[model samples]
Target: MDEALLRSLTPSVLAVLVRRGADFAAAEDAVQEALVEAVRHWPDDPPRDAKGWLVTVAWRKFIDTTRADAARRRREDRVEEEPPPGPASSVDDTLQLYFLCAHPSLTPSSAVALTLRAVGGLTTRQIAEAYLVPEATMAQRISRAKRTVSGVRLDRPGDVATVLRVLYLVFNEGYSGDVDLAAEAIRLTRQLAAAIDHPEVAGLLALMLLHHARRAARTAPDGSLVPLAEQDRSRWDTKAIAEGIGILQKALARDRLGEFQAQAAIAALHADAPTAGETDWAQIVEWYDELAGLVDSPVVLLNRAVAIGEAHGPRAGLAALAELDDSLPRHTAVAAYLHEREGDLTKAAALYAEAAHKATNLPERDHLTRQAARLNAKRRA
Candidate 1:
């Protein structure tokens, strides 16, 4: 099968159906039908007009589905029964698909899952694998999301903020089974930045790229976490750095700063320096200040603590961390980080293990666990 061609056409197919006023469920069914048809035909007879073919087949499938379910009332036929445009759809179709998938009405988890499935052109199994959830569970989640959006009125106004949050979640997830969440996040963010004029969206795209550019050096070969100070500068993706810088510059010019824009500014500062030692920690602290002011989220404060360590000292950072609510997730992780910085490996190792126990995601928990193991091993060695 022409997998690349299918991937290329998937978003366009969904976007077309959405534009034609099919609610989310009907549109997804249409795309699924197009996918099945592609699998059947592409190997034997690859079409020169994949988009047109999918749109035609999907349109027919949507009509068939509505007709079969006598329960569903057919809406007024608003979309013209027009032929497909000459040539294929522009890449903007993919952006539209993400925007539609991340529609605000859907729950955040549902929106993320649907965007990965529809715009990301990934299978339910693939998404399931990525999030470390059972395939059946992910299937149910996606289906439930579809049902929720089925009868809702279609709105094209991009949920830029929600889209950014979804993309950030994808990026921060690091990696997963058969899916590179960071890479996917970058792709989705690029599409979002292109499709929307929101500076914060652009800021998020830049931040993801900036952090992603360093992914190679962020983990040891055995999957152990590597602190930023120890990461090899040569391993960073220079092209991604360039793009990130460009986006950050554009976002900064807008003057209407949001939390994401401030975070991007911090990432940009880190990326600009050739060496870790050269990072403008003072400037980063300023941006973090702005971010703290923008959102009262505990994670923001936690991040600010790390930045305080960089700008001030470990003792000061630990002091700042102490002031935060003890009930927050990652509280122990911040304490462990600060303790590790303070030359108190004993306390750090114990706290790291505690952090691992409290961590929400597997990668982060594993990382902290490994840190504790390494420290224990080092004491013996």
Candidate 2:
């Protein structure tokens, strides 16, 4: 299916069509046409200027569609042969495309779907697979997202931040479905960072890299979640780690310290240690504290509890965790860790079982279940 050709051409295809002034609907249709053409032609004559050819052809096709639709005749000249001179000359249209895909007017799910389609060059079926939904469901989602943004004006400056956040979510899941969402996210974020001047975008890229560096060690081949301390330190991606640290250091020096920057700081601290034992728990706790203040989310608080536990004592961690809601998903797991640390193996084993049952994903469930099994094995021994 000309996979490499498609992957290489996709970002540019979407970007050029959009930059030529096609709205989401038109740009999407144009890119789809280009894909169909690629499938038909790439076996014989691969165009020399693949991206340019796709963009030029898609732009023309989009213009034709707009002209034929009586309703769209009002702006037949919506796009000029060449765009006017603008701010940020070095800025690429791909960044603008991200903002459009992540337009707040669209629902979060829809935004994700659109971004996958437009930027990731994924078909509707692929997006549906990742989201664990039907292809038809995801198609409707993309379509609705397109229609929702048709009326909204989107050239504002603040739009880039929203775009960066949406991409951040894509990277955070690490991996999903058949696609490596984390890799796709890193690719897109790099595109955005290169095209834009925003420091937060750089910060998001740094954060994604830091988290992604740990992915190889995050899970075992059997799909078991590897605890941070148990992870094979050698498996960590040193290149991603170095890049993350360099970018993070630069962002921290800016003194903006946005939420993304704070999270990156925490990740950087963890990555700096030779082993989990060598981790700067005190600094990590401080970063988590800053993050909690910036985002005010319970998840951050729960994570901070773990850091506090490492920095101080298990009992202190438990005390901090006690302040959070019992309904939180991390509730039982944190309790089990605290109990185990405080020398209550029996109670800890019981809590581990509960945590396993409550776990959301397969790896996490398996991890907690194994924790219980270890404690059980000790009893039998």
Candidate 3:
């Protein structure tokens, strides 16, 4: 059985049931049941039309479940006569599904979970494993999310920005357990891009590809984090980089510059560089300026400060950093780097130690500690 094919068909199949008057929760559950059946039987006897098979099986499952429920007596009348097994309707509701899964009514975590299950075609257990949470916990989160959107009608358009934000959140999760959420987010975003003609969608896909292209060199053999400037360029995926650059170029040409596009521009700039020293920091600072204007985020400005430090001088970067709140994440680390560049080894070492103490994860803390040690040893020499 082609698992990818099955997952690809899941959203459209679930959408068919929902369009045919099934509630979102019941329809999603029924679609999952259909997927299980496919996994069990498709190996011995694959259907000619996968989507149609799923739609038929899922609709029947929904009807059966609705009929069995005492509280859903009124819903039974609508699902009493199951549609005959035939080709599923070609009316794609995947875009609508994306918007619904990212509904503002749901919390960010719930939205990500629901998008993975209902849109990305992932199982609750898979999502649970990826998030390092209990299966029961993830199940409850998805259940609540489905219930929250159950009453919402898919008659109006959804907020595209919300959908993009949810996808970005998924991408930022990177990888955990058996699920590479970043890859899953890319796949789902690709699906969304196919459904909608939005430049931001294309921009997001480009950004994911560019970032993912460098995954092989992001860590050392000891699983230690490697800074971008130190990563081996030979390890990068050239194919993915080329593809990302192409997509980004097309999106930029459309003249609809959103935050994602601006971000992709920065990623593309990094990917374009053949060596760390050859990076166009000035251009990157300009992109960061554009990104800051688009989002008004402190993190964006923080990053811009790094680019400014590289583009101009360490003192200039320090000047930019001083104007912002020092409480931002990674603020101390950036300060350390800038101080070190300004030939203030003692101050840099102290700041690195402080950043390590504030680190949120083990790898980051270890990396920062190593930086402090290196600076202190240099001073001793």
Candidate 4:
């Protein structure tokens, strides 16, 4: 069975059911059943029309489920009469499904889960594994998300920003378990970009491409974090970087200047450099200023300080960091780097040890611990 093909057909199949008067939750469940049946039987006897087969099976399943539930008898009459078997309507409902799954009513985590299940065609187990959560917990999260948006009208205008934010969240997850969420996010974003002509959408796609281009060099073979400055530039995907730059240029020309566009500009500048020393830190700092104006996020501030350290000096970076709350995630890490740059090895070592203690992930904690150890050894020598 072609798994990718099945996943690609999922949204349209679910859309067809919804258009035929099925509620969001039931239609999704029926479609999932159809997918399972396809996996079980398609190898021995593949259907001539994959999507049509899925729709027929799923619609039947929905009808059977409605009939089985006494409380849903009232809905039975509306769906009892099945439409003639054929291709679903040519009008693309997939885009609307994207908007619905990313509805503002749902929390960020809920929206991410629902989008993965309904739009990305991922199983709850797959999502759970990717997020490092139990399958039961993910199931409840998805169920609650479906219920939250079930009452929303299909034709309601969706906030594009919300949808983009969810996609960005997915991209940032990188990869884990069986799901390459970063790749999945790119696929979904590409679909959305095709469906709608928006600069921010293009900007986001550009940003993901540029960032993904460096994935191969983001870590050492032993899984230790490789700071961008020390990464082997030869490992970066030049093709992806070129594509991202072209897209970002077009988006920037549109003059919308959204946060994603600003961020992409910074990424593009980094990608353009042959070495860390060659990077245009001043341009990046300017872009960060624009980003700070667009989104008031602590993470952005933290990043801007790093750029300041490169563009001006470690003292300037430390001054900027001092304005931020010390409790901010990565605050100690940033301070440690700035102090090291300023030649205060003792203070840097102490800060690195502190940051290591506060690190949330194993890779990060290990990296910080190594930084402290390296600095401490150098100080002793």
lDDT of each: 0.80, 0.81, 0.92, 0.93
Residue 29 Cα positional deviation in candidate 2, in Å, after optimal superposition: 0.9
Measured against the true structure, the TM-scores of the candidates, in listed sequence, are 0.85, 0.89, 0.97, 0.94
Going through the candidates in the order shown, the clash numbers are: 0, 0, 0, 0
lDDT of 1 by residue, 15-130 (tens): 77777667767778678878888889888998887877888888888877766654455555444455445344445566666766777778878988988888767788889999
Model 4 misplaced stretches (Cα beyond 4 Å): 70-76, 84-92
Please say which candidate is ahead in lDDT: 1 or 2.
2
**Candidate 2 to truth, TM:** 0.89
TM-score of 4: 0.94
Worst 10 residues of 1 by lDDT: 78-87
Q: To one decimal, what is the Cα RMSD in angstroms of model 4 from the true structure? A: 2.0
TM-score between candidate 1 and the true structure: 0.85
Question: What is candidate 4's lDDT per residue for 1-381, written digit by digit as tens?
Answer: 789899988888999998888999999999999999999999999999998899999999998888777455544355678976445442358888999999988999999999999988899999999999999999999999999999998986588899999999999998999899999999888888887788999999999999999999999999999999999999999999999999999999989989998999999999999999999999999999999999989999999999999999999999999899989999999999999999999999999999999999998999999999999999999
Instruction: State how far residue 63 of model 4 sits from its true place (Å).
Output: 1.8
User: Which residue pairs come into collision in candidate 4?
Assistant: none
**Regions of model 1 farther than 4 Å from truth:** 1-5, 67-99, 156-158, 344-346, 361-381
lDDT of 2 by residue, 53-78 (tens): 77667776776677677355554554
User: What would the C-alpha RMSD of candidate 1 be, to one decimal place?
Assistant: 3.7
